[model samples]
Target chain A: MRMPKLTAFLMATAVFASALVASADEVHVLNWKGYGADEPWAIAAFEKATGNKVVNDFFNSEQEMLTKLRTNPGLYDVVMINAAFNDQAMAEKLIQPIDVSKIPNYADISADKAGSPMLARDGKVYGVPWVWGLTALAINEKAFETPPTSIAEMWNEAHKGRVTIRDDAVEAVQFGAIATGQNINDIKDMEAVKAKLTSLMPQIKTFWSSENDWNQMVASNQIDIGTYWSGSADRAKTHFKLPVSLVIPREGAVAWLDAFSIPVGAKNVAGAEAFINTMIDPKFYVEWVTKVGAPVSANAKAVAALPEDAFNRKVMGDPGVAKRIQFQAPISDAQREAYLALWQELKVNVK
Target chain B: MAGQVATGARSGLRSALPLLVPAYLWLTVAIFMPLSAMVFFSFMTELPLSGKAWSFTLDNYATFFAQGLYRTLLLASLKLGLEVTLWCVVIGYPAAYVLAKVFRGRSREAIFLLVILPFWSNGLVRIFSWAMVLREGGILDTALNAVLPFKINIDLMYSYPAVIIGLVHSYVPYMVLTCYLTLQAIDDSLIEAGRSLGASRLQMLKRVIIPLSMPGLVAGAALIFVPVVGSFMEPRILGGRTGTFYGTIIEDQFVAVFNWPLGAALSFILLAVVLVILALASPVLKRAA
Candidate 1:
């Protein structure tokens, strides 16, 4: 009787141990494509170090990501959201405040980026700065004898019908404001924005919406200059061998920063924190920046550690280049509506 | 016997339910439910799914009136649709007529397949392919430059003409297919009869062939016009900066601006306009049928 009881106890212990071994801590990350720590070595090391698995879901745009997060609460443990959208995400209680104590590498981020209002709210830190990029002017190098240095160059009569702009209303309106020497951020006066944007109509050959479309135009010599992300121009030159170059106009460019935030009701907060820390590890950041081309990492050590080759792309690792970036502040919902309304009018009257 | 007949009719319906249910159920779930939901959401202040404060309001519709932009864009889109449909009719009807009446046997079948071969591949990819042909220094440019003594620049990449070309190319196949279907059913005897009655070829075509094929023409026009009016992708890819339409604005609301209620209102209004158009065309269609 004693022997049989001991055998049953051993069998139950074996079953319980198997269950424990099967269930690993998981961190579900919602981010843009190519934004996550996608390197095999990084992923493997992370999994081995923390015994947690990272699963990723990607969104093409901020609004799409917002829609997914808003519709499915607690679905994602970690989200890499645009800094401009952090306010709205927090206001809606979609994401929760971060405990800095849980993320040790959070301290290694540059002070300027760390102290930005985008990552903090009500004196409580909400996000860890991840990567930074800019939406600047991309020009075909062969189109002009000299490099254009000002945003106003886009509207010059000489380049009439040879230029393109992004098909984004806010960005277009902001550029218009900047061009006309009006405040890009506040944008209180609708008529001013309208007048400025409408003045650009004669010069615009077309408005491109996608990077691929812009690249094709450049390759086919359809447009002399256009508005696209700075990193995309770098990628195009390196990958497609396009004769394109990115320019930061004297009027300043709209800069965006992406950061990692934990959503409210996240099932694995600890694992999410670990994943965020792992992402900012200098070794991982180096690999990420090297592989992904020239988007700056917020971590100072990572920037310092980048080899001369990756560091040569001054836009990526140079702090001086970052100073030229004018970060876009979050806008009120009403402002968004008014801007879209005016933009629609501008589009209708483009001819 | 009357009771037996009633029972037979009931049994027929019962047997048909299985076949009808799958399709009707799919339509109800996929089409009707979303459409009804859109109408319901159009009257709201905010998206209820967002868990934000919201209320019922017609201000969304009122904005359409308060601002004339939506109406203007809608008019522009309709004009685009009309232009594309007319071009397709001019270009496609003749090709379709040849396919139906001119050629015979294997060649006709093969040509018909070639005409619609584009529809098989992805629509977006096909639109992109046109960029290689229509843009500056593209196939058309290289070909033209190769033959001409002097250089003549051909840069239609982001122009209104480019948009029209892309749209017509995308939708002309519909015209061919529909016109071919109806034109094929017309008997040769009717043409011979018209000829015997002292009618000329043009007269026979104008009075007989055209009138007989009115159903296909109307059907093709409706089919082409509806989608073209709602097209945003073709214009974006081919029209460049010149490509904002009513459909693109509606798209902006959902994806760019994150305003579902407003987008829903815009979509619902578009649906109403489309329904009215289809309604107006129904009488002519019925007569032709």
Candidate 2:
């Protein structure tokens, strides 16, 4: 009787341990809503392939994402952070260096993105560069006889009361920096930037805050030319059928990258790696790009696999464009406050 | 006799304690605790939870005093509040008088529903709907151009007037609802007495209706003015580049610039100003009561 009871107890322990292991396979993801990670089909495919369940939470802004990570340590196994904020995340120890070996698809990522200083620290990779896009000029094709070649066209008298820009201090300051022939990440003369933005104010009909706002403003002819995202511009033209064309001016454009990283003290590190690998897979990239209209894939193989006339392939595929692009860098808190103050002052004086 | 009264009062307190416990507990948890925490944070140099080195500092409040922009925007917001409140009163008082004095039975109920209809829809959808009506080739423009002999462009989107229109549309219902309640409560005999005294219809309204409805009018103005002073959304959606206000700047400090300490300070300042305004209006409100 004693032997039989002991055997039954051992069996129960084995079953409970297996259940624990199964529960541990679940991956919690933090990302922007609708930004590739939480796609239903992708999540289903990843779950089926790796036998790991995926759950997602979304943040509306990058700062909100940071706050979430800081407040909820060990809750999120995977997080999507912008390249510009990678250093700050790393410094705060919010995310850990990802083991690239676990992500087999990492080999196919473009060297420029994979090796970017923004994603690495002291020879260790903290993030897997996922997607990139440009914040360049998007113009109403029907409104212009010829495409604008320079960022200075935003100030042209012809487009007065027909031009717009985003209502963001960082974007406005960066645009000013670019127009003044200064690096976006490093501006030596903020006075020049302030002066440039102040002059552009009268030409602006309005300022858009979201992709929907941009679409409405342009569709109604409330604006003729404005600073817009490349991916959003592509969606406007292809999905909404708006007569919009993105222009990479002679002064180049502001570029930003988004990456997937494992949060520090995550319970399911392997599951997080598996999810990120699936996220950057070429097949997934092609589907996301063609159907949903996403930013350009960081994976070189994925871009090459897209159709010849794919908007990203036609516009951002050139190596020369890569050289001209200025990838955003981490901004100090003091610098951000200064930009905000200047932007607010300019908005107050716009009329 | 005093001792007996004190005993009675103690017994009354003992009886009411159980009923008041839940309410006081809720207030302590939901309102006072958070407000106390905000007060503490307003004096800090940084967010204490951000894992950064921080200490108590008066710099946050000092920045407000040193900067002229905050004062300018706060004044602008006050002006906006005053304009919106006056418009609500001008538009709503007459409608309320009609609802209370003229309309009867089912027609009154139907019109009353129409007055409160703006509350049925989401605030954003309503604002956007106004945008559709007020844009250049929008409903208003299209209708006007279709009926008129000459082509007149009505590009009101992204202007100050658009913001005012959207805000007034949103808040006028408050004025109507409050004034209607008060006007309905006033004895109809008062108006009859005024008219029997050989008063004109206008004189009857000025003497009998307006004075009696003062409570509701004061209540409605307070309701509209408080929110409008701190409003950021309607102004943003409709006012375009012209939309930057004190409230929007405070929003920027927290969300865009990650300056929570400064945001807390600015918020505290706005709260203090609002309190002072309410304090100044208390005598009038009490008199109306």
Q: Which lDDT tens digits does candidate 1 get at residues B77-148?
A: 889999999999999999999999999999998998999899998987888888788988888989999999
lDDT of 2 by residue, A167-238 (tens): 899999999999999999999998999999999998988888899999988788778899999999999999
Q: Candidate 2: fnat, from 0 to 1?
A: 0.51
Q: Which pairs of residues collide in model 2?
A: none
Model 1: CA > 4 A from native: A1-24, A38-41, A309-313, A316-323, B1-8, B284-289
Q: Which has the greatest DockQ? A: 2
| Model 1 lDDT tens row, A1-351 | 112222433453353344232123787788877655655677889989999987766776786677667766666889988888899999888899999888989889989899999889899988899877788898999888888999888878888888888878788888777676666687667677688788888888888777787887788777888788877887788778899988888777788888899998788899999999998888887776566665777788777787766533465555556656678888787887777777777877884
Which of the CAPRI classes, incorrect, acceptable, medium or high, describes model 1?
A: acceptable
What would the DockQ be for model 1? 0.33
